[model samples]
Target: MTRWDAVRVRQGLVDSCCSAEQAGDQALRRGRPREARRHYERMLAEAIRLAEQFPDLSTRRDLTLAFNKYGAFWVGAHRLDQAAEAYAEGLAVATRLREENPDDIRLLRDLRFGEFTLGEIARQTGGPAGRRTAHDHCTTALALAEHLVGTDPHHTGDRRELGVVQERLGLLATERQELDEAAEWYARALSVRRELAAELPGDPRARRDLGVQYERLGDLALRRRDLEAARAHYDESLSLRRSLLGDDPRDLSTQRDLSVVCERLGDVALLTDGPEQARQWYDDSFAILDAAFGPKHPDTRTLRKKLRGHPVTPN
Candidate 1:
């Protein structure tokens, strides 16, 4: 082909890749899963072709993004096998890129994300071996996040990433019933998240993230029978979550979070404030969760079990 023909072919390929990516992202934002899948699959195909035909660093990077998007789509769909395959493929490409450019911070961050996602999937799909493997992967991700935070302490994203990794470690410890270790890890994450929330007081997402840590800590306190401490944490979580839910009352996840915190507070009240106060809290939780998730849902069912012997009046 002539020089002009070659340039035209290259431009066409780039346009195809760009268009597909844009379409996929737009579809996802609009909650059109079928359209998103079609666009993402097309993007992946184009990326793969570009990677092979061009064999350049930029093309390979695009291919890596394609794999990551494909994996994330499958993960959201709960297709674990497909998610695993996509992640593995993307991770392999990321690993290669990391080897080629060890100092590339972008590649390092991508690797951490890939590893974290894979570990979470393993953790959710339980087995002794799978859990152990997940722990290892998450530990590696924590190390990477720590290093990144050390490199840029003022970077909010890096700090949040470190906090999340610490939280994951705490979860793993909790699963193993290592209460002391779990508490220590959670405390570290809580410190970071608290700082982040304070730094960005206007950001609801940051506050919500801190609230999550508080809720986890509350759960830990309950496990340790520290009723007062549990109440304090739950109260803090409830405050933040209420503010978040106030901004978007229709967000079912936020509503569910508020319900969980209220239920925990009721558990504390049951022990100290007697059945009347406890009953009020329990009823409030039941109302919220029953509305957000039907009475037959697991969350509502668990709430029912908790209220069984107590016999609270349903609203």
Candidate 2:
């Protein structure tokens, strides 16, 4: 084919596959899963074709990313088997690339994150047997997280990722009722996140990570029946989350997090304060969900159900 023909083919690939991917993203943000899936299916088909046709670094990288996102979508849709298959395929591609470029930062991050995501899927997979798989994935991810951070300790993103990895391990520990182990992991995560937040006070993501660490610690405190500690941690998270949305209360992501803080505070309120205060907090949380995602949304409906009862439970 001539140069012009080759250029035309490349443009066709962009218009066909990239455009589909973009449309999928937009549909996902709008909560149109069926529409998103249609677009993603097309994008995946094209991505596979592209990778098979040109097994170069860039095409292979795109293929890896395609599988990564497709797997994530399956996870959200509650298709565990498909999610695992897609993630495993992505990891295989990524592993080949990492072997080729041993010290490459991008590949290192990809492998680390891929492991972490796989751990999540494994944890949610076939009940008891999934636990061991989940733990192994998380352990490998944590090691990669440490290695990535060690490669560039000054890199803020890598440091933050280390904290996230620690937090994921902590979550698994909590589910296993290993409170002490969970606490240790959470403490480490909090330390790293706190330092990042303090160093980059202006960065919204840094503050948000610190806030999430506090939220998780607060959850642990609640599990231990340390009401006062839970309240204090929740308060700190609320403050930080509020700070992140100072002028943009409409920011759905921050608002959703803030809603969690509110619901947790509501739980504490049921114990410390009266039911009135607790109801108010729950209302605040539900209102955010109702407005952002509509009342018919799963989350909104769940919260609405909770609001129907006495609201004494700690859901």
Candidate 3:
């Protein structure tokens, strides 16, 4: 193709990528995973075609953005392997762009996000190499986030991203049973999330992460037989999740978790009280489970059997 024709074709590809990304995002938000996948795949293919059709456009910021967006879609779809590949491509492009234009702050930020995502994927699928890779990438991303927070405290997105990285770090520490370290990380993340919530109460991601951190702490407390601590943390988690999710059927995961916590607390009550009070707690626990899982669910059936076997009497 002639030079002018090539430019037009590249622009067409860019437009196609943008359209695909928009469609993919909509599909994701609507919980249409299959449709989202199709859009993201199409965007990736178009990006590759553009790269081959016009080498000059391959490293352009727009093209890099397409890769990043596609990677985000893949991540949302739980296609972590594909997400990593897309992020790798985007990172390479961003690196080249940054080298050529050292003053491009946006490109630098994108590179950091790419690295953060890579770390997330690695952390989710653990082996020795995966753990090592996750640690390195998360450490690098953390340093970058810290720098951003220090230099630009008003940048809410940077602070939020820092909170996310800290939460992930907490998860890693928790997995290793480093309770103190995990608590420290989670506390920092919670602080950032609280700040973000104060500024933008409508944004729920930070709040959700905070709930998750609380639940993790509750699990640890339970393992140590710290019943009071576990109860407190689980209560906090349930309250937050209830506020954020309400009675939405899609939030059954959180609902089930809350029910489990209630059942555990009921067990504690059984040990401390006579049959009447114990039975009350057990009834409440069963009610929560039935509401969360429905009566026909396997969990409900199992809990029902347990309740029947225990046969709490009215004192």
Steric overlap count per candidate: 0, 0, 0
For each candidate in the order shown, give its overall lDDT on alpha carbons: 0.89, 0.88, 0.77
Model 2 C-alpha lDDT per residue in residues 259-311, reported as the tens digit of each score: 88999998998888889889989989998888888978888888888888864
Pairs with backbone N, CA or C atoms under 3 Å apart (clashes), candidate 2:
none
Candidate 3: residue pairs that collide: none
**TM-score for each predicted model, relative to the true structure:** 0.89, 0.84, 0.73
Candidate 3 structure quality by residue, lDDT tens digits, 52-74: 67655343666677788878777
Backbone-clash count (model 1): 0
Query: Which runs of model 1 end up more than 4 angstroms from their true locations?
Result: 1-4, 21-39, 290-309, 313-315
Model 1 reaches what TM-score against the true structure? 0.89
Q: Which residue window of length 10 is worst by lDDT in model 2?
A: 306-315
